[model samples]
Target: MNDTTRTVRLSVDCMGGDHGPSVTLPACRSFLDRHPDAELVLVGTEQALAPAAGWARCRMVIASEVVEMDDPVEVALRKKRDSSMRVAIQQVKPDGNGVTMADACVSAGNTGALMAVARYLLKTLDGIDRPAIASVMPNQHDGFTTMLDLGANVDCSAEHLLQFAVMGSALVSAVDGKEAPTVGLLNIGEEAIKGNETIKRAGELLRAVSAAGHINFHGNVEGNDIFKGTTDLVVCDGFVGNVALKTAEGLAGMITSFLKQEFTRTPLTKMVAMLAMPMLKRFSRRLDHRRFNGAALLGLRGLVFKSHGSADALAFENALNRAYDAARNRLLDRVHDRILATLQALPGAGTTAANEPPAARHAA
Candidate 1:
């Protein structure tokens, strides 16, 4: 066992992703090699964990079942009680001795199922009504922008967006070391009057929080503003956030394919490509999505990060690195503190106020 004060124990679902153990086990090996103070709890079937047996700093937890990439949320929650994914997340829960089994959990599994299991098992933090998925994206300023609700809660209230801003701010602050990260409300335009009633209301709530010395709200921002690094954190409902994220991913893929096609079009182009290989490689490295592979399920009592189901070894390793960083930084505690502070500052708008009288609380 590592004697370092910063040792982080991470639970990994070895059989959850597209390539299963073939991808995750190698990624675990690479992660352990780089993080000497980190330990891993590899959760999967006995046969699936055979390759990881010889790895140092790793302990295997046998699971009898596997959750497929396309399994429905109901099936994962109800049928697969002993699935590798569920078992991995279970490790984040406190054991019979009231001690946390792991610092955090990482999984490249069905997004819906992971969220369902995590929420059901670990539950949300003190003042957060719902959890949001926050991920870092590359920006024009050579820094990263964090965006939240990236497919966790499709329908959100203005209050939910407000809570998301708090959680996103806490996440960026903890992981990126930003003392007070700026927040932007994703909308149709930069003006105050744009977007639906829900967005306008959300903006109002964000401003209120800012005035209360809770968040650094930067008003409204458009889709293009995301790449410009207009704010360190962006908040939106899952429906819109998911659409924006997928669109960006599709555009990146298309651009890469186009460049490849053009470069291989002719011998003349191939010669030019060889001449510019150094510059092209640098550009590719900067925009590679693998560098930002993990998305945190913020607001949970315990930390849980979701990786792309088809992530390769490098990408999976990046996900593990992100989880390790969050755990080391005490992200869960930071989020809880921020939410509790915000609730205390606002008098009648208590934490439970948002959940009670659902219609009135959700209305724009």
Candidate 2:
């Protein structure tokens, strides 16, 4: 290994993804080829995982079942004991013979089940009301923005938002190399009185949370502010944020398609396209949400990441790198101290992590 790089063990769900192991195998192979020290653990039935195992060096974890697209979370966790997703999560138990979550576990499978499994296996940190899904997205200035709760929580409290603020701030710091990130509350308008009651309450809570001198709170920002590079971090409930994220992705795609048509309008334009294609490809990849698809189930006791179900191999590699970064940074330990301290100091902020980890219950 090089001086700047370290090895990271990653668990990949072989049965998930649009093309399953067919596309995933090549992506994993590409990643392993480039990253000599990286190791992969493939989870699925032997039949599904075997082909990939043949071409690349990987551990084949036997998973007798899989959660189909329409399967309910309850049924998958309860009835499907041998499911690929379940077996992968079980590895988090760390029985001394295998890798634990101190190494990260990632899935491009049923997101709900993955979240449930992580919640069950790794558990949440002390005083973290709900763990969030944080996505790193494009910034106009050749950088990225850290946005959270992209479908993790539907309804949020001021307390929950405040907690997200701290975690999200830490995330931007860790991934974006920003020592202190400016946080923006995603609202209808860039004003305090613009959002609904829940958001308003969350806003007030954010103000109080910011007063502690921890997060650099920038008050409110509209969805349009994301491209303006107005803030380093954007915070909101999963529903609105998820919609906004997907919309942005669709918009990016549409813009790219429009540019292609524009460039194809004439023979000279075609020459311009040929010359600019490489740069455009790089720019498009940089802006693709899936390029930054992995989101840590923040506030968890150990490493747990959720990637886009539609993620490809490049996206998988990105997720793996992200998980490695989170674990190396000791996110769990930091979150524990920050959350407990924040809660203890706040009004009605009163829960604590139990003696036993939440990994078991969330799994169920």
Candidate 3:
């Protein structure tokens, strides 16, 4: 059924995460509770969700088999014809057209499996070297930081990084509403000849691409500058981005825990904590990972947001909101068109990508 008369429907992979329905069910409930205009298609065994969900009545797509987190990507894909991750993607497929007219899919399952399934089912858009996972990191400033290839692909070349820079630029523009967001190359130092060959090669290529006005490349930035908002977008390989993100999350938890312990150590400290409760809460909210769980799998034909496995009801709700923002912004379309436009202006304007239209390249 059409859950709303306004926004598009979203397919939730109910069986893909560590907490499974415990996390997924509450999230689905929270999403519908807030956004009545968004419809959802839950993909997982009714039995699996029955215990966790109190008989949710959203449009349902029964996924008979579930690939557990420990299962291998290829092995799971081979057996589970009706797995939650696979079916969730099918609903968003333009060919399938099962979930209204939305160009999106979301899953909290095995990171590699989700990407593999999406790549096969959704396919990549034209001129997109590869699909990169784009994420938002809260900045120390009033705004948020953006990064791409956040574990979508472990290996990346200069061309891939160049493409990522372009996608990351557009994402920051659309998500942050920054017209010309500064894009940075994730590197060891500010010098032109720093780090390994890949970083050096990618660094030089990004400079050329940015010089051509594809993006506002901000040379090179150290790991510490990520939270400082030195650049609006940071382009890096999945390995580095993933490790950095995980470290930041761990540090946030440690910081909060330490504060709690210190505040309860003495009556005076407790009194001070009570007095500064509001400011502390605001600061904590800014650091909360729930608001930042969703990551967009960009360079694909559609919008696909991946949330953390431990994501609770709030994170799932935010994931839905993120999907709505991306779809309405025509994000993928804008990125593809921009890429083609840039390619057409190159020396071999008549070669490679010019022959195919945006829709044609994305038309799986």
lDDT of 1 by residue, 1-364 (tens): 1223756899999998889999999999999999998999999999989988778888899999999999999999999999999999988886545467688899999899999999999877767789999998899998999999999989999989999999999889878989799999999999999999999999988988899999999999989988999999999999999999999999999999999999989999999999999999999999999998999999887889999998999999999999998888778767877787788767678746322210000001
- The lDDT, on a scale of 0 to 1, for candidate 3 is 0.76
Question: lDDT ranking from best to worst?
Answer: 1, 3, 2
Sort by TM-score, best first.
Answer: 1, 3, 2
Query: Which ranges of candidate 3 are over 4 A from the true structure?
Result: 1-6, 48-58, 96-101, 266-268, 345-350, 354-364
In the range 222-289, model 3's lDDT, one tens digit per residue, is 88889998999998998898899889889988988999999889999999999999999998898888
What does candidate 2 score on TM? 0.85
Which prediction has the highest lDDT against the true structure?
Answer: 1
lDDT: worst 10-residue window of model 2:
355-364
Clashing pairs in 2: 120-359, 120-362, 120-363, 121-359
lDDT of 2: 0.73
Candidate 2, 189-284: lDDT as tens digits? 988999898789888877776687667889999887887779999998888888998898888889988988999999999999999999988977
* lDDT, residue 234, candidate 3: 90
Worst 10 residues of 3 by lDDT: 355-364
Of models 1 and 2, which has the larger TM-score? 1
How big is the positional error of residue 204 in model 2, measured in Å on the Cα after superposition? 2.5
